[model samples]
Target: MEIMLTPAAKAGLDEWESNGNKKVIQRIHDLVESVQRTPFKGIGKPEPLK
Candidate 1:
């Protein structure tokens, strides 16, 4: 699912990026990564290209 970052979320992300807050950025990255890894939204096992 495509995530639409809200204005506040965008600001937070931008701030973290600009501030070089690796911890906060890592948390955000982890959240997104976990979401993408889920089998939700009809996602199944990854398939190799034929």
Candidate 2:
């Protein structure tokens, strides 16, 4: 499965990294990887957009 971020999300991530939130950025990447590995059973509960 592929994960694509919206433009706003990309900008927010960039801003977070630029503001020295490397750890948070890494955690986001980790979560993405986890979701990729197990879409319905990863770190956080998976929910539908509704």
**Which candidate has the highest lDDT of all?**
2
Q: How much lDDT does each candidate structure score?
A: 0.73, 0.88
lDDT of 2 by residue, 24-44 (tens): 989988898999999888887
Q: What is residue 6's positional error in candidate 2, in angstroms?
A: 0.8
Measured on C-alpha atoms, candidate 1 has an lDDT of: 0.73
Off by over 4 Å in 2: 47-50
lDDT by residue (tens digit), candidate 1, 5-39: 89998998899899998997988787777666663
